[model samples]
Target: MIRFGPAGNGNSFYEAGHKSSLEIPEYLADVGLNAYEYQCGRGVNVKGEFCRQLAAKAREYKIFLSLHAPYFINLGTSDPKVMESSLRHIAKSLAAAKDMEATRIVVHPGSVGKNSRSEALARAERLLAQTAAELMPSFPGISLCLETMGKINQLGTLDEVIGLCKLDKCFMPTIDFGHLHARDLGAIKGRDEFEEVLDRIASSLGAEVVQNLHVHFSAIEFARGGEIRHRTFAEREYGPDFEPLAAIIARDRLTPVIISESAGAQTEDALAMKELVQRYQTGEGGRDV
Candidate 1:
């Protein structure tokens, strides 16, 4: 629903003991943010009655919920045990998300170790397909989104992720604009390029998918291939260009949940993006003015 949000708990401004994931939805609600992505990066630490309470609270506040699976996952691993473990984690994360009434779960496609890129991608696809089949019955409403990875060593690419989404309707692509920019070493030059990426996604998965996009954005540093680390929006020199992205979202009437991943300044950046989107929607800038 064109939701703008931060990656983790929005209460980073609060003291450590004063904040918890359960308190985030209400805080975000108070701050005018309608969406939140629960970060289970280390593990899905929130469980049982706590999860159910959080779900109820999120519903009470009308906060749109999503989850990021643990960073330790590697579905493309050559070892079957590793793959199985990844699957189990995904299944558990999905259950947690279900309890929290989360709509989607974002996952990394895993690294390309000794295998060739294509081979790794195929392996990831098979593993994800199998995982989806197993989870479909239980988490019927949750969509599993494979995110585009920034580094060259990782299996995810825009095309590769789109291909996986095409394989199954339940699967979708979470386009990380910072990662795309880093992956290409700042190739997304302007509005047209941004539009083209969205066009490609629409072409691959149909226009309806654009209506509920799961997106991540920030300024990033990259070396040879792409993505070294995230930077604050103000700190970025070379970029994935937010203005053009804002323009595209305006022109296309796209409704995406944009999660800001700016290092240590996520809430501030998210608010800035929301303001930009609102301005774009209302035609406040020179071209429209």
Candidate 2:
């Protein structure tokens, strides 16, 4: 279906006279978008009944729903107390996802902290496996998406997330292209570069998952540390250009759910990417959305 949508209540969304997150799906459907990502990046603060009604509204509008879990979860922690806290945080997010009937819950796979990268990753792996074993039975329908972090010190690399996905049946890779690009110092450019990523995922996980990917796209500013911030579409010169990825998506006829993470213009940028894909598929050139 090649779904294109925004990360949260987009910049334009607030201007359109909306206050509640639950009001997003109908607006998205009205604008030809078929997907919605509700952000609980701080934490899941709502009641189960609230999420249930939100899920029902999304289903009524045929919008695919996904949730971004809390930002504080760091399963790579060396401290036993912090690890226990992380477990509780993730479990709470999973419970919310089950109540909301969300297809996926995006999570940052944790950081290296004071430990060596290898040690942190190994810790993360064990924690994730334990999490799956404990929670999968209760929340079987939702997938835990380990995100590709933009920072170098963080545990989430493309390979790291892919490895984590292999740790459990409940996990999947959340392919944050902006984070990948930033981590590689703005590496992605043309079709070959973009296809190399898709190929790696396909080779590792299988083609079906690759074809129906959950991808994030945005132009990012990066330093030696990686991922300074996400930029708007108006900053065209700064990019791992969407056109190349759009071309590949169209050519391969993949059914990816692409979420835009532009600082404020996420919905506008997502619509722009959807337009770019349409232009490529139709073989027309140079039209903006």
Identify the candidate with maximal TM-score.
Answer: 2
Over the stretch 1-289, how does candidate 1's per-residue lDDT look in tens digits? Answer: 6898889853364744446678877787877788888889998777678889888988998888899999888977889898888998898899888888888999998999998888888888898789767776688888999999899898788998999888777899999989988888887888777878898998889898877788998888898978899887778585776888887788778899999888877888888899888888988833431
Measured against the true structure, the TM-scores of the candidates, in listed sequence, are: 0.95, 0.97
Weakest 10 consecutive residues, lDDT, candidate 1? 9-18
lDDT score of residue 37 within candidate 2: 84
**What lDDT does candidate 1 reach at residue 265?**
78
lDDT, candidate 2, 119-228, per-residue tens: 99999988998898887678878888889999998888898898889887688889999899999998887777788889999999889888989999999989999888
Cα lDDT computed for each candidate against the true fold: 0.84, 0.87
How badly does each model clash, as a count of residue pairs?
Answer: 0, 0
Best by lDDT: 2
